[model samples]
Target: MKGISSYADTGRFEEISLASSSYSSILYDSIRDRPDFKAGLSEQAHLAAKFESEAKYSVLNGFSYISKHVNPHKKWGMLINLSSFAKDANLSLHRNCIYCSKAVDLNINAMVDNNYNTFYVAEKTEAGELGEDIAAMQQYPVTADTSVSTLLLSNIKQGERAIIVVPLKKKNFSHCMNFIHHAGDGIVVDGQQNKLYNFNNNADKKIFDSLYGAASSAIKPARIYITGKAPDIRNEAWEMIEHPYFPDNDWEEL
Candidate 1:
């Protein structure tokens, strides 16, 4: 009874119209000689018609929702810069050195000296409701090729510090830097050449403080250059800083 009423409200012609004309006619003729039988058949026919209409509408609404919300064909590109670490001799670039290296096995430092640190690059494609999946991707070696290169060496010379320069794609460099900081790696403080230095472990704290002081006093600004695009999560996670360099459109297909 409830289903029949719902069917009437939705106005699904396929269920009510066809049944009312075809099936109802047959039932009516068969029960014409008996008033009780005819009345009962008509009541069942109305309920059946209503149920059919509701089913059709429910299916159509479900499909519409999926089509609007599901991003089955969406794609984006992730460019990672493994170059700086790849060219550095002080850092260990071996496969067993970094976390998750065995699983990703990018061999990014192979393009540069073996002593360099290895970084990762990835591109991703998203499906309906599901997150991104790494598609065609690669990694390359990166090195400080600018005047601010001194900042890197100076931090290393300080003995317990490692200098990291994350370049801003545009004016909003803080957004990206904050992401790396919150990831539990370290705290980012101002450094030379627009670069920020972060220290994660207790051992590196002094290094961060010293670098922060030195960078603040230095006349030359630090340069933060990335060899490749960072991962999707890293990019999205950092909302404070906007990557001016990130392209406006997605390019997962390429």
Candidate 2:
């Protein structure tokens, strides 16, 4: 892969990401001397959420990918409120999400405003492969890892286009699960609550099949329920892993 720096086109702002809308706008800055070029993209993203059926899960998985990358102790699923982030970033499409005002909404406008390159992320289709633990432990013969966000937003955009160079914020949490337990209720993104419960305990794990939501309609989990026909296929060991931001965290005083 070529260096991401190859994509840089900003002047003052560090070119950390990309964006695109249907038409064009002056909301964001321009591409240096190229004043014709604009920044901030939103329309395509809203349209994506409008069409996708499982956008909530996709957004959660995207956050999961982010969590894994941004020095997290673990990468369990997360929940985010569109209004919270949208309002922070000044993207006014929070009311247009397909899930309505659900905690987990995918508004690219807000994401872009918040400095995420949704266009770039939407293009991330195949994520390579499953981890050894997941591959071996999973019932089916799983191989490569596909993208969930791609499922949420295809090549769609709103009426405007802009290229925003996002500053690399120290925090990559997006205030998903790691934060925002208050401010209101939170919807478990595609039922990652199961993993949250199982993995949160570190040493302690549930032997019996634990469940969430209404008992009448309660299912194993979005992923497991889709495959595991038998309700009793919940036997698996758990272990905590140390995913450090630095390589092996071997830094010593020189």
Candidate 3:
């Protein structure tokens, strides 16, 4: 697994349960059950049980965390906006943050902004206290090459996975979509082959055809996170990021 895979998240995202006889994933089954491509091991499957379980449950994990601690009273407050995947603390999401809002019982006064709000991702490790200890994702500004699948996660190593949570619209809340990018190279075995795409190899042309706009990019934004290379002839505290493709969690101090 070395490239990023994107799945056009749709339909009822059931609470995944892999039966003993068959470790088939409800998410994977909804996409395709034909077993067209040969995925050697259970882990080889692009969005297998392991990957789907993580991506799907992380949402619940994050929501529970914010509801309990951030707003101990679960009252109106600001939350780390998850609208557009920006890593900078100051550059919070503009579009209504669904998950963050939901955590506070859909409190209209609960503004999704920066300030001291924390980015809720999965759950914090049991030993979490330090800033770097919390699992979070840093935003990698999408380039022309990154706009497509084949090139998005080309920089990551094989066998690892990345979760791609596509934010849904304000009107649509029933169907929640969660993408698991398992820098993987394989195919699934099931029915309904209409909603999957592997970054390494795939039969479908487009899996994310259902996704659309978030908002317009500003002419000159306040802050910008630089990924990949920091110019060879560098200046100040700038340095190269050893791993850029697998930036799963890079949040700020809570």
What is each predicted model's overall lDDT from 0 to 1? 0.21, 0.20, 0.22
TM-score list, all predictions: 0.18, 0.17, 0.24
Candidate 1 per-residue C-alpha lDDT over 73-153 given as tens digits, one digit per residue, 9 for 90 to 100: 122101121232245422211111111111011211111122213222111111001001112111111222332223343
Encode model 3's per-residue lDDT on 82-155: one tens digit a residue: 42224443332222122222222211011112112222221211111101111232223332223323322343
Task: List the candidate 1 regions with Cα displacement exceeding 4 Å.
Answer: 1-198, 211-218, 229-254
> What's the residue-level lDDT of 93 in candidate 1?
16
The per-candidate count of clashes, in order, stands at: 15, 16, 18
Model 2 agreement with the true structure over 98-186: per-residue lDDT tens digits: 11111122232333244332321111111111111121111111112322122111211222211111111111110111111111111
Ranking by lDDT: 3, 1, 2
